[model samples]
Target: MKPRALMFTLFGEYIQHYGNEVWIGSLIQMMSHFGISESSIRGAALRMVQQEFFEVRKIGNNSYYSLTPKGKRTMTDGFIRVYSLKNYKWDGYWRILTYSVPEEKRELRNQIRKELSLMGFGLISHGTWASPNPVEQQVMELIRDYHLDPYVILFTSSSIVSHSHEQLIKRGWDFAQIAKEYDRFIDTYQRIYEEFQRRAWNNELSDRECFIERTKLVHEYRSFFFMDPSFPHDLLPDNWSGTKARELFFNVHQLLAVPAIRYFETLFESAPDRELQLNREKAINPFIGMI
Candidate 1:
């Protein structure tokens, strides 16, 4: 994993549990298990500050790093998207996007297209893309950021009269490929699930095991945000594997949480606001939807 990504995962998956700020020394130590060098971690932390993902707070001689407001918002949204579930009940509407970047600004065109794609928009035709979810805020943010407001037009449609729903879905999305990813996710975790079930009575998962397994599961499952458009049941194909995969994800995450919480809580003891943070985790854990 890239140092930058690992940094964010550290905040989202662990440090956020210990309150927003962590001593830089402690942060480096936490990442040591992943084989990241201290220098590399420091470099990444500095870059994250420059990029506005983190900010430093000083208490005397030592420096502690915490997610900036931007970082906190993004991480919260990301956690909800990655873990709470990929599928949201769809409203019967389509967010249609049409844009015409000048040929002279071809680079800008590519940039906009790439950003929209990352937000789950699928191309309908050249210069036209669509998403089932609302994209107004994200789209406008991009337009403003790139100064492409004059080139873009966005609209929402309650229904499409001419095209069949299946046609739109098939044309816009690669369900076959997504199903393959779901298969891979299920296969990866199914063994873990079986092992946990087999050892149900033993409760043998160590705190370290829990931390490793849970992090790996989270890191792997987070990829779904890039792959899934999260269309409702009607839009997806029959027997979509993502559904089954999500079920397995929830199960394995909860099973690991039992021991993982034990391990991470030990680290939080030194955090000055640790008690406040632990209470928040109690509230947020439900939102992690550990069913």
Candidate 2:
């Protein structure tokens, strides 16, 4: 994985629980397990700071980093979606978003498209996107955030003249490819889960091993957020593999949780600002007890 992406995974899954801050040395030590060089970690940290995802402070010879408010909000929103078990019920109305950003602001248009895709909207045609999920409020927020209110229009419609719902879905997304990816995820993790279960039963797994495995598990599974729009069950293809993949992910995650937390706390307690971290209320893992 790219060091930058891994940093987000680390902060979201681990560091946020311990005051949402970490000494640079502590971060380097943790990232070492993934074979990331100290220089690379520092470089990634600096880039994140530039992107407003992190705030850094110097203390004597060392530096500490913490998530900015924007970063925290982003991580919180992501985690909510990642761990959500709510089966979205389609209301039979499609939310359509069409934008006509000026050519002078091409970058802004690209950003709007990226945000729409991340929010599960799929492009149905040039400058037009749609989602069966109710996300009008989110689209409005995006519009206001980008000051694109004049360039964008949103609509809710229950009818399409040219295509049926299934046809629209096919035009907007490659479900066949998505299904193949889900199959791969299920196949890979099912074997890992079986092996981990055996090791756990045999008392052969180390706390550090559990931590590594759990982090890797979450990191790998988290990619589905970008790949899967998480359509309602009724809309998914028959015998979709994503359902089985999710179950496997949660099962393995729960199996690794206790030892993973133990290992993380061991590192966290040794940080230079341990007292401050200890005094802060711990945030619960969203996946805990949700399986």
Best by TM-score: 2
Error of 1 at 251 (Å): 0.7
Q: Give per-residue lDDT, candidate 1, residue 104.
A: 95
In order, candidate lDDTs are 0.74, 0.80
lDDT of 1 by residue, 4-50 (tens): 77777767887776666788887776667678899999999999898
User: In candidate 2, where is summed lDDT lowest over 10 consecutive residues?
Assistant: 277-286
Q: Highest lDDT among the candidates is held by which one?
A: 2
TM-score of each: 0.81, 0.88
lDDT (10s digit) by residue, model 2, range 1-291: 788778878788878767778888888888888899999999999998987779988777888898886567556555656777776667789889888988999998997887787677889899999988877867776776668878999999999999999999998888898888989988898899999999999999999999898889888887877767778878888888888888898799889887887887777623464565542223335565332
- Please list all clashing residue pairs in model 2, or write none if there are none: none
